[model samples]
Structures are given as structure tokens and as C-alpha cells.
Target: MDITRYNSEAWDREVESGNVWTKPVSPELVRKAKAGQWEILLTPAKPVPDDWFPKLEGLRVLCLASGGGQQGPILAAVGARVTVFDNSKKQLEQDIYVAERDQLDIRTVRGEMTNLAVFSDSSFDLIVHPVSNTFVADVLPVWKEAYRVLNPKGTLISGFDNPLLHIFDYEEYEKGILKVSYSIPYSDIESLPKDQLKKQLEAREPLEFGHTLEDQIKGQIDAGFIISGFYEDNSAGKEFLDRYINTFMATKAEKVYVDKCRDLA
Candidate 1:
């Protein structure tokens, strides 16, 4: 199966269904951004810290897999040269819709998150990636590509689900009971029961992969990112896990230059 294509189509339907992430940011928000007042989410709850960002004016920013017209428009309004890359056409359209409505300068590119061949090396100064990586099967390549495309000392801010969120049985979760029926590094495609999988397919929902903290955090480090900031957050809704512990996490990392010849010795 072409996972990227399937998830793209599913997310298009999600946009039609008014999924919160697919909704466009309001024009008023863009206006405020242009006025030097703005905040955006890298996780479900906390807004990204102001210090995590450099001067926005004239900086190249990549909104990696973070379409939905949210982050890209705000950044563009604030004077960043913005490009939003995503797998879903509808998601990309949200960015375009906001850009056109606000007359903001923004570029929208459609592609898989792991493959950033469209961009050249050291092409961006900042990459704002939200919680969308759960849909991708492998995340290390995403980190590698992000590291490659970022200029030295560039920032990478990202959010991801804690894999423990997937260890519970979904039915039990709905009942406010967290039953450990699955292991870490979970995949709805491979781990869910046949009935559950059928239901997800019938509903046209995108499949999810649950990567470990190791894969999510250490992968960035392995990709040559220096971990700088970190935080944990819970889902916004009254979910079972939210009652117990935070189910989401966000990280701020910076790319530092390394001498390849010295490393090869």
C-alpha cells in the first residue's frame, strides 16, 4: 500500500469533516501576527517559547508536514519566508487559502514528510514540525532530512505522541480503563485487531504509528541535533490517558556543525 497516498486522501476527508488540525487560522490571528503578536502550538497545549525563535524577518522557515493553514500563515505574516510541505493536498490548500485571504507570502509543497528532495541542503533556518509524524512509519529519516536541510545552528521544533499512549486497548481506553494490551513501537496497521482495522478503514481515518521516545528524541540527536529544550503535554480533550499522565511531548533542538573528516578518523 502507498501509505503516504492513503493518508493524504484520509486527511482530505478529515478536512471536510472539520478536524481541528485541518481548520484554517482566522484572519484576525494573522492580523495580530503582522502586528507582532502571535503564538503557535508545537504540541497540543503549550505554545512554543518566544526565545526558541530567532528574528522572524527575512529568515527561511519550513513548516514540515504542518499544513492546515495554521503555523505557516502566522510565520509569513510576521515576515518569515515560509514554505509549508505536507502529504495532504487539502492540508496544503489550507495554507494557500489563508495566504490568499491575508495576502501573505507563503509557498505550499505537497510531498511525503520523509522525502524532502524538493529542498536543497542548508535551505532553511528554522523548521516547525508539529505532531503529524505519528502518521509516518519511520521517523529517523525525517530527522535526517530535517538536519540536512537546515543551516548550521538552525532550530528544529517538533511535537509527537508518547508511544505509551498506544499500549492501551482502544475499547478499554474509551471506558476510562488503561489496559496494556499492546507494546511500545505500535502500529495500528499491524497491531490493531481485524475488526478495529476494518472499522478504521470504513471510517476513512488515517493509520497511525507509535514510535518510542528513543526513536523520537534520540533520533534527532543521532541526526546531529543538540537537544536544547523539552516539555510534556496532555491531549486537549478528556481522554483516558489525559487523566493519568501527559500523552504528548515537544522538543526544541539545534543543528551544530561537525567536521566530517575528523569524525571519519
Candidate 2:
């Protein structure tokens, strides 16, 4: 939705919305994101492996948003050659700090998540996007970019708040479940401070930033990457699943598949 028009004020509105960029991620919070924590907080019907990251001896991995570089460092420690991309200088600085502290070799680049074309196609073995998609208005572009840059066999591991969760108001429990709270085809309109406009343009888009699982799947397949795994946090329940189905997945997906793509030249 003409994401490029956003400024700092627009971004601040997003932060205040308590939807995207709800709170500034503190160093303490990033410190808490240890490996395998995903499994603990994000529940699944069955246990996924603690060491889900494949052996990193020679994998080329990309970390989006580099939130504190917490995950990037963990991946690098295992010997994967890692690169981290983020739009926020403050956040990337934090990531750099963590990388230095951990003695990791994660390279940082300043860029928007929806445009990964700067990185060559089939250049990476894995991509990690942790709960940051909500910050952007549209995720299809991000998925397409990811698929383009990721090797055919490369894997994408990501998570976001369940859309149903978006319908509730945490401050008022009674209003939490109301479906009319927002349009079913949600739009991410936000207001921000004028001084922050430039940064906002870099950090977020002007359009709404949520997607249904079907949208996520189709966007990826449309970009030429097969879905490998799909996990939804059951904690959000029917409401969120309902929105996800309407926005992302009207048709049930067949078995998710993962295969290797030839290297990008």
C-alpha cells in the first residue's frame, strides 16, 4: 500500500497501536531469547526438535531484523556464516553489540525486509524471521523476496502473533473478542511523529502489515518455494485461526515440502 510514503511519525503510530512495534525491545528482553526458547513459549501440539537449526558448518544464513542479534549469534556460534539485515539503526546497533559480546561474525546491513533483491537469488541456505512481519503492512512482498534470495532447498523459519489475537483489546478483557473491532481485510494505518518520518520509511511500510497463513503459503509458492512447515500457536484459538483462513488460507494446504534449490550464481 505504497509503503514507501511512511515517515517516522507514521512508524510511531504503529508502535503506539500496540499492534506492530508495540514496545521497544530492551536489551534484557533480547538477552532472554536463548536457543530453544521458541519451543517453550510458542507451544505446538507435538514437540519440535530443540536443535531445529541444521548443522551450520557451511550454511549461509540470513537473519531478518537482527533483533538484538540474539538469534544471529547463536547461529554463528555453531559455525554458520551469518548475515543480519535490519532497517532500524538502533536495533542493528544493539545486534552489533550482542555480536561483539558473543564474538560472532554476523555481518549487518541496513535494508527493508520486503526488498531482499539486494541479496542475490539462491544465495542463502536458511532465513529466520521471528515475529516481525506485523511491523510491515504486507507480507507477500517479504515472502517473495525471501523465496528469491533463498536457495531452493533453503528453509525459512518465522512466527507472528495470531491474527485472532489482533481482535482483542488487552486493556479491556470484555472488548477482546469483538470481531467488528477491525475490518476482516485489515489495513495497517498508523500515525507517527514528524521527526521520525525518515526512519519510519525505513522501518515500516504505509500499508497494513498482517497476512493469513494461506496468503503466506501462496505467496511463497508463487515465488517458487515450497512450504516446509506450518505451525500455529494454539493459544490464540478459533478467532485468530478464522481470520488467518480468510486472509491467508481459504484452501487447505497439501503436505508441506522442503527441497534444495541449486546455488545462486
Candidate 3:
């Protein structure tokens, strides 16, 4: 299956069905953001640390795979030159909707997260990526592209699911049981049985992939970013796992500056 095309259509359906992530922020939130009072979430629950951001005025920011009209508009309202890139057109439209409604300037680009060739090298000073990469099969390329497009010392704040969450059976999980049914680095595409896959397809749910901690964390480091901050969070819907363990993680990292050397006399 063409994962990109399938997930795009699935998420467009999500937008039509009013998924919480597809909802745009209220005008009052934009108003406060314009006045320098704002907070955005990388994880489901906790807002990103203010210190993770540099001064917002006039900085170029890329909201990577985060075009749900949430972070991009707020950052634009706070004076950042914001561009939102996502695979889902409906998701991007939410950003456009918020931008037009709030009279803020925000650019929306529809594309896959792994391929960011539309952007030039060092094009952005910061990237705010929420918990969207679970849909992508490979995440390392996403990190590499993010590194390539970021300026020296550029900040990247991202949220992703803990691979551990994928280990439990979905049916058992609903009943507050934690029966292990899958391994880490899980993919719904490859792991699900025919019946379950058919059910997910019939329900119009986007497929998910669970990347290991090494790929999600060390991948950023290998991409030349310095991991600076980290936090763990629980899922928002009062899931069974939330009572025991946080199922999400957010990380703050920065591209390091490298100086070219010249031969001395």
C-alpha cells in the first residue's frame, strides 16, 4: 500500500469527522498569543517549555507534520514567519483557516514528512513537531531532513509515542489489561492480522508505526543535533496505560554549529 496516500486520505476523513487534533484554536487564544501570552503542546498533555523557544519575532519556523491549525497559527500570531508542512491537505486547510480567521500570516505546504526537498538548506531557525510521526514508517529520514533544513543552533522540539505502548493488545488494553501482543518497532501495516487490518481500514483509522527509543532519540543525535531537554507524558483520554506509565515523550534538541577549518601558514 502507498502509506502516504492512504494516510493522507485517512487523516482527511479524520478532519471531516472532527478529530480533536484537527480542531483549530479559539480566537481568544490567538489574541492572547498576539499579545505574547501563548503555549503550545508537543506532547498530548504538557505544554513545551518556554525556554525551548528563542524569541519568536521574525524567526522562520517550520511546523513539521503539524498542520492541524494549532501550533503554526499561534507561532505566526506571536510574530514568527511560520510554514506548516503535512501530508494531509485537510489538516493544512485547518492552518489556512486559522490564519485567515485571525489575520495572521502562515504558509501551508502539503507533503510527506520524510521528504522536505521543497525547503532549502538552513531555511528555518526552529521546528515545532507534535505527535504526528507515528504515521510514518521511517523516522530517521525525517530527522535528517529536519537537520538539513535547520540553521546552526536551530531548535527542534518533537513529540512521539513510547514504543512500549505498542506492546499491548488493543482489545485487552480497552479493558484495562496489559497483555503483550506485539514487539517494539511495531507497524500496523506489517503486524496486524488480516481481520484486524480490515477492521482498521473499515473504520477509516490511519495506520501507525511504533519506532524504538533508539531511533526516536539517538536518531536525532546522529543527525547532528544535541539533545538538550526531555519530558514524558501520558495519553489524554484516560487510557489504561496512563494510570501506570507515560505513553509519550517529548524532546528538545538543537543543531550544533560547525566551523570550517583553513590551513595555517
Candidate 4:
């Protein structure tokens, strides 16, 4: 929504600049991200469904936005031959360190998520995309590429914020048993401070970049991956909202929640 912050120059600056969170292997930010307890908060309380689990042994997997290897490392621990990919070299390198620490066999690669033709078509058994890709407005390109790279019958295990959760403000306040400052999606707007921006890059912000459910399901179908399962954990969002304004609803203005048709393409 505040994509104005991510101009073409900003994206390129991230590449040329060597800042940890901004750049990827940003050593300082990586360690900080790993050390922070907030990540544990973001993790799903319940395990992902069995059907969503990719067959680990001999299955080639790709992890997008493998920030500090949260999901990637977990999947790797389960014996998946995983290759973690991200635009941030610093982040990937940090993940590499974590993988080494855990003694997990995980590979790291740096590249844009939307275009994965660098790898062969039908090359992977599964793809794990977490809270990333919503930053790129056109997620279809990424989904299309993922389909191109995965073999027929291959699975994709992806997770992101439920769009419905996006309609809240996170400023500090209390009102209801669940204090809510509901707003129309993308209305309660504020520019992220520089430090906050880096923090977000380090800990993937699903709400900031998640596509609507309709689009996500459509992406799976169009890309040829069977939509095996979907998961939603509102505990974290609700918890966060209770302390801050739940911006999903209007705080200053009357709001309307519109259900627009989402493109699966």
C-alpha cells in the first residue's frame, strides 16, 4: 500500500547497498532478527497440515524470502533438500549461518521471487513461499514462474495474512473486549520510518504484502498446483490489535469492506 517507499531506486539501492536487513546477509539485522522474540510470536501455534507438508526426502524445495530461515530451516529440519532464495543476499547468508548451526542441509540463492526461470521448469517438488511476494503488486508473475519450475503434481505450501485481517489500525488504544478500530483496507496510512522499514524487511510483514484469498487460490489453480490446503491463525493479529488500534475498520471515517473478484492468474 505504501509502495511509494519502494521505488525502483529503492529496490536497486538494496542490491548495491550492503546493509544487512536492507541488503539480505545484513549480519547485524540477521542476528537481531533471529534473537528477537517477535518471530516466535509470528509462527503458527499449530503445525501446518499434513497434506501441505512436502515430501522431504529427495524433494527439491525452494523457499522464498527465507528471512533468517524461519520456515525454511523448519522444513529443512524435516529432511527436505531445501534451497532458500531471497532478494536480500544478507538475509540468505544469515539463513545459511542458521542452517549450518542447526546442521541442516539447506542451500542459499539470491534472486527476485517473481522470475525464477533461472531454474529449469518442472525442477522442484515443492515451493515454500511465506509472507513475501505481496510487496510485488503483480504476484501472478511469481506464481506463474513457480508453476513453470515445479514438476507436474508438485505441491506448493504457501502462507500469508488473511486479507480480512488487513482492516485494522495498530496504534495503541483499548475499547472493546477486543478493541477494534476497523477501517477500509489500505486507509489508515502512515509511512514506515527508516528503522521500522529495515525491521519489516527482516521480519516479513504478511499484512503489508499478502494477496487476497481469492487471488492466492486462483494463483495455485492457474499455476497448476492443486489447492490442497490453507491455514489462518488470527491469534497474533488479534493479540496485536488488542494492544493497538485494529486498523481493519475505520477509526476516523465510516468504512466499507468490499469483496472484489480476485484474479487467479
Clash counts per candidate, in order, are 0, 20, 0, 23
Candidate 4 per-residue lDDT, tens place, 182-234, comes to 43232222334456556665543422543555566676566555554554454
The deviation in Å at residue 71 for candidate 1 is 0.5
TM-score of each: 0.97, 0.64, 0.97, 0.61
lDDT (Cα, tens digit) per residue for candidate 3, span 100-203: 99999999999999999999999999999999999999999999999999999899999999998888888788888888999988999888887998999889
The lowest-lDDT stretch of 10 consecutive residues in candidate 2 is: 247-256
Question: What lDDT score goes with residue 242 in model 4?
Answer: 31
- Superposed on all Cα atoms, the candidates' RMSDs to the truth, in angstroms, are 1.2, 7.7, 1.6, 10.8
Candidate 2 residue lDDT tens string, 150-205 = 77667776655545544443235344444334433344454233444445456654
Those runs of model 2 whose alpha carbons end farther than 4 Å from true positions after fitting are 1-51, 169-179, 190-208, 234-265
- Distance from true location, Cα of 264 in model 1, Å: 6.9
Candidate with more favorable, higher lDDT: 2 or 4: 2
